[model samples]
Target: MAQDRAQKNRPHYALASVDHALRLAVMLQVEGPLSVSDAAERLGVARSTAHRLLSMLVYRDFARQGEDRRYHAGPVISLTADSQSRTALLRTVALPHLHALVGRLGESANLLVLAGDYARFIGSVESSQALRVGNREGMVFPAHLTSGGKLILADLTPAEREELYAAQRWDGREGERPDPAALEQELAVVRDRGFAINKDRTETGVTAVGRGVRVGDRVGAAVTVSMPTVRFDESRLVDIVSALALASRDIEHDLQAALRVEA
Candidate 1:
């Protein structure tokens, strides 16, 4: 019984040690270089054990031990990230649908992700028009004033919306950020309407309509079709809204499939 108890405890202790080593590596990645003693202190392990873990990590190129004896994340981990980003499975899956919409409508289409208090434009298909009104890729804009932002905001719970707005300092930033009561009213209408519209809110002559692009239970992102107000009159608005809704559904389906495979 004593020997069996020792055997069981040995594997548990080994796993704990491995866990500590992984924690040390992750800490180095997040907090930059750390001496062995510092890593040991943060992990509540002895210097010798930390040294052994660092050696193993260095051998695998997960970390590099510098002349200063401080450890930092190394090329192997960075290469893995580069590889994953290059794949960009979301963009790959959505491209066909986005191109179809752009080709059919002759208006710009974009994919946006909510980052901090803003919507970041990740990808876009430019309108074929001689004059353009849509945002360029990699542009970041206030979420409270754009159709993509409104689409994302409309899907959030009231509590979640309050938390986001509080962090963003919306009151001071936007001249037209609706008061909480008014925002709540607008959000209710957005939810019922199944899409959101921006009427020259972000830029003077541009108008856009957007719909939520969801992945599973999470509102992963949004899609928008944008044009100048003169080009997108009331009749054209209906066509654009309908096209965006279809494109959103297609993107959501692909996003869900990609996520399932990733899982």
Candidate 2:
């Protein structure tokens, strides 16, 4: 029994629950990522207990809930410095495509990556049209309120989504969050369609459509086109979606090639 304990020397006064939580944290930091069920199985605990433990970990920023619905080492974890090389490579491969998208649709295009609970615009190309939306590069927006943000958030599992939008987090800032039911309905639609559309949701008189840039089964980023609301005709939606999809594919292809070369 002592040998099976998390530590070689099990303390007489060690609280089992605390030990379990610590062990889970270690597993997250060392094992990369794991689901609640996986943690429970490994820790020999009940599912509810595992969930409570993981929630506490998230609350303390000891672990983070990933888009894949697994827990990864949070910022507080003492891992090696995160390399910005991936983001740099992604931006390098995606800039040309953003410009091409602007040339094709005559609308501003942006490339964004998930940053914590926000979407960070890393690449942007403004349209030449007099009435077009301007460059939004280096801007960060609430993940739930942006076109690309919603598309990426919709890709997370239900448990991961719950952690991100936990009721307690919105206590004083209720207005900033969307109605749970309405947001769920919209996310379901975005998931089914593999894209998202925004119309005056984040900014007034601006409309946008976004598609995820995928590398194999994982989405690496979101590519979107934003235009003036007056020019956002419902008839043009199909064309906008098609253009956005092509841009996404182009970015993903180049990103894959770049990463392959690096590997």
Q: Pick by TM-score: which candidate is best?
A: 2
- Candidate 1 lDDT over 145-171, as tens digits, reads 677877788788888888876736755
Best candidate according to lDDT: 2
Give the per-residue lDDT of model 2 (tens digit) for 22-43.
Answer: 7777556534677999989877
Scored against the true structure, residue 158 in model 1 reaches a CA lDDT of: 81
Candidate 1 runs further than 4 Å off: 1-87, 167-178
- The global Cα lDDT (0 to 1) of model 2 is 0.79
- Candidate 1 differs from the real structure by a C-alpha RMSD in angstroms, to one decimal, of 18.5
Model 1 scores a TM of: 0.64
Using all chains and alpha carbons, the TM-scores for the candidates as numbered come to: 0.64, 0.67
Worst 10 residues of 1 by lDDT: 1-10
